[model samples]
Target: MITVRPSGQRGYADHGWLRAKHSFSFADYYDPAEMGWGALRVINEDRVAPGTGFGRHGHRDMEIVTYILSGALEHQDSLGNGGVIRRGEVQRMTAGKGILHSEFNPSADEEVHLLQIWIEPAVHGTPASYEQQALPVDAMRGRWRLVASPDGADGSATIGQDARLSATVLSPGEALGYALAAGRLGYVHVVRGHLALNGIALAAGDGAKIGEETELHFAADDEAEILLFDLPPTH
Candidate 1:
């Protein structure tokens, strides 16, 4: 079964400095029926204004991952980790027991576009940790690049969950495929441009939930970027 999630239907929050779209409930946007998909808890698409961003906030027992699409995000956390996450970079933080962090756009004039994602930890109260990696365009061009996983395989940043995140960049007419095992579920998020997933059309910001499927296919109609989530059955 394939369920399409149009971008327009997602919850929205425009704080002037932070315009965010919630794929799954986060902050003040809540929907009982739209709680989450399996272990994937939150997917917040954010556009942070230049010179402003999120202040110190706390999180616990969560696998938090941040991806920068454009511009850059400066991060500081309770673990004393601080750095700038540039375009094509991925950052992961394991808030085992608890942790405080802040995200800010370092640019004084250019807005930063990014995604903030959260996954339920496979285990609780381990220890707080952080990791970051910069992916070159070659790594994602025309293929699924594993960016996050349970063990940080292939240099992917480790998460606290039994899930894998693969990212890819596609050009017009480019195609990609993945085998969807019978028991594991799938989620596809188009970051930008138009695409056809198994003949179903999807636009930027669109998402699809895959269940009981045998294969996953993607074709780009224009230059596009996407993230595919191989999710576990626990939410």
Candidate 2:
């Protein structure tokens, strides 16, 4: 089945300095029916105001991934890792054992648009680690580029789970396909522009939860960017 989650239907919160939309139940936004998809626990599309962002926070046993869609976000952690993640860059933090971190918009005049995602680790309570990788525009043009996986496949950032995430930037009329194993599930999240997945139209911020399916085929209606996840079943 392919279940579509419209962008406008997500849980929204505006905190002056931070505007966030939660794809799953998070913080004050709780939906019993929208808990999460498979091992993916959270996907928050956030827009941080100029020179403002999240304060120091602690997390544990979660694989946190951040993708900067626009502007930049400065990250500092108790592990002594600090950097600025700009557009097209993906940062992964294994919050095992425990980790403290802060994310801030460094630009004085520009807001930072980004997606912060959390995935449950297959193994927990291990040492915390961090990694970041940049996806060049050319690599995703008209094709799916693997960005995260359990083993860092294709130079993708390694996660602590049996999940694979792929992203794409397609030109108008371009197509991409992904085949699923018999029992695997999938998820598609539209980041920008417009596209049609298996005849279902999706615009920016839309998502589709797939299960009991075999393959996914998408064609761009215009210039579009999307992220796809091959996930192990929670049941």
Candidate 3:
């Protein structure tokens, strides 16, 4: 079964400096039916104005991953990790025990566009950690690039959950296929342009939940970027 979450149907918040759309309950936005999918808890598409960002916040027992869609995002955490993640980089932070962090748009004039994702950890109360990896544009062009996985398979970033996350940037008419093992579920989020997932059209900011399906297909209608997750039934 496949359920589509329409772009215009998501919870929206415009805080002047920060405009965000949440696929799941976040901050002050709450929707019981849209709470989350499987082990994937949050998928927030955020656009931060220049010189503005999220202040230091606390998190625990969550495996957070950041994927910059455009521009850049400056990230700093209490674990002493700090850096800028650009369009081709993926950042993962495991707030096992606890951690405080902040994200900002450092540019003087360009807005920062990114996706902040949270997945439940395999085991709680571990130490906090951080890792970032560069995903060159050439490698992701027209194909799925494994960005996060439980075992860091295929050089992807490691996560504390039994999940695998992959992303891709596809040109018009390009396509990718994903096969799911029995009992495995999938979720897809479109970042830009458009796509047809098994004949279901999806535009930017749209999300889909998949279940009891053995295979899925993604074909880009235009230049499109998307994130795919393989997750357990629950966090």
List the global CA lDDT of all models. 0.91, 0.92, 0.91
* CA error at residue 214 for candidate 2, angstroms: 1.3
Q: Write model 2 residue lDDT over 47-145, tens digit each, in one string.
A: 999999889999999999998889999999999999999987889999999999999999999999999989999998989999889867679887879
Top lDDT prediction, candidate number: 2
Ranking by lDDT: 2, 3, 1
Candidate 1's C-alpha runs over 4 A off are: none
Error of 3 at 154 (Å): 2.3
For model 2 the local lDDT of residue 175 reads 92
Q: Give the TM-score of candidate 2.
A: 0.98
Off by over 4 Å in 3: none
Model 1 error, position 137 (Å):
2.5
Better of 1 and 2 by TM-score: 2
RMSD of 1: 1.1
Window of ten residues with lowest summed lDDT in model 1:
226-235
* Model 2 CA lDDT for position 3: 98
TM-score ranking from best to worst? 2, 1, 3
